[model samples]
Target: MDLNPKLPTLPAFYQQRIEALLARGSRRLLGLVGAPGAGKSTLAQVLASQWPGQIQVVPMDGFHLANVELDRLGRRQRKGAPDTFDAFGFVALLKRLRTQAVDDVVYAPSYERSLEEGIAGAIAIEANTPLLVVEGNYLLLNDSPWNQVQALLDETWFVDVPQDLRVGRLTQRHQQFGRSAQDAADWVQHTDEPNARRIEAAKAKADVMFRWDS
Candidate 1:
């Protein structure tokens, strides 16, 4: 795992708290979600590595609409918008992963970064496997789809970072993924920043706040 990014005090403590929660839940599921560049994925990975119990992760990114689908809908430019994901499909998968009682392998969806789309049957969430952690953006929005999804999460934590830091990181991340520097900056300043603001407003809906003081 890359530790290039140091762990801030609040996020580290949040990770410990998640591990303790997993220990107590034993067979129950837990969810960690936040906006883009909010560090939810990193937190999930850290917690999973420390959890002593059997752990499995089902990321909400797994439900992202395929690139082809986006193109067909004329929404390729607005890829990460909440409307772009297959909310119903994600809800179905979450329901199955949360309540099904079979012993066979439970196939969970997974998102492919290179392909920039979601792939079904890419991950298996082994039936009855405990300690499921789901992470993603827009999991706590009070609106229709997000509100519906929140009901499935046993516990939810929102990762909060300074606005400046988040925008800087997001711009860099976009450039790393092949976006032009100018385009990346514009995306971060416009689309991404607005989304971050919406998510920040939803922080109050989270059970806990995972923030970095520094």
Candidate 2:
């Protein structure tokens, strides 16, 4: 229960900076972009937990194309790749989140890892929620609609860790989701690593880049 000693607690300055954003009296979108196994989700959850009602995570994974659609497009082997997501729809959601927060609940899709699909209206972002912690692998990508995401965010952080650690975590995650050990490793090497390279290349576009070390 004592995460104080074990977890990678966020630095005080980062907390202060987020507080300053909340003080601005306007809704803010904060983005967390990183490689597949780099702990972006973990870091975002930690931050959002600290702020409680003031911050909620709106993940880009929710924009993942369905397994059936990926199969239809012949992209099932590369499910986590940027092209396999609904980039335009994700961008539209981010734009809507900017204004819809005060008028009523702004519902966001959520990725169901067990079912391996995005469930619509899974996250209900409450009215006047002060900040949204958006986490994903491609927010800072310079390609088309994903590129448009950076300008929409009030601030962004690119989470990172050594490649070996990332690969290990990704393999373990895949295995947990019913992948055979060899299949998990193969997926990481052939699929996730290629995407990691592209995501890592865009780190310079983030407001800050740091090790998440989950």
Off by over 4 Å in 1: 1-16, 23-26
TM-score computed on alpha carbons, candidate 2: 0.94
lDDT of 2 by residue, 1-214 (tens): 1122123566887888789889988889999889987887777788888888899999999999999999999999999999999999999999998878456888899999899999999999886788899999999888898889999999998887878777888888888889999999999999999999999888988887766454
Q: Model 1: per-residue lDDT, tens digit, 1-214?
A: 1222455333456656666766674456676766677677776776666554467777888887888888999977777878888887777877777776766677877877666767788877776566888888888877776788778877888877776666677777787778999999888777777777777788888887777633
RMSD per prediction, one decimal? Answer: 2.8, 2.6
Give the best candidate by lDDT. 2
Models 1 onward score TM values of 0.87, 0.94
Which 10 residues in a row give candidate 1 its minimum summed lDDT?
1-10
RMSD of 1: 2.8
Give the least accurate 10-residue stretch of model 2, judged by summed lDDT.
1-10
lDDT of 1: 0.73
After TM-score superposition, what is the CA distance of residue 1 in candidate 1 from its true location, in Å?
16
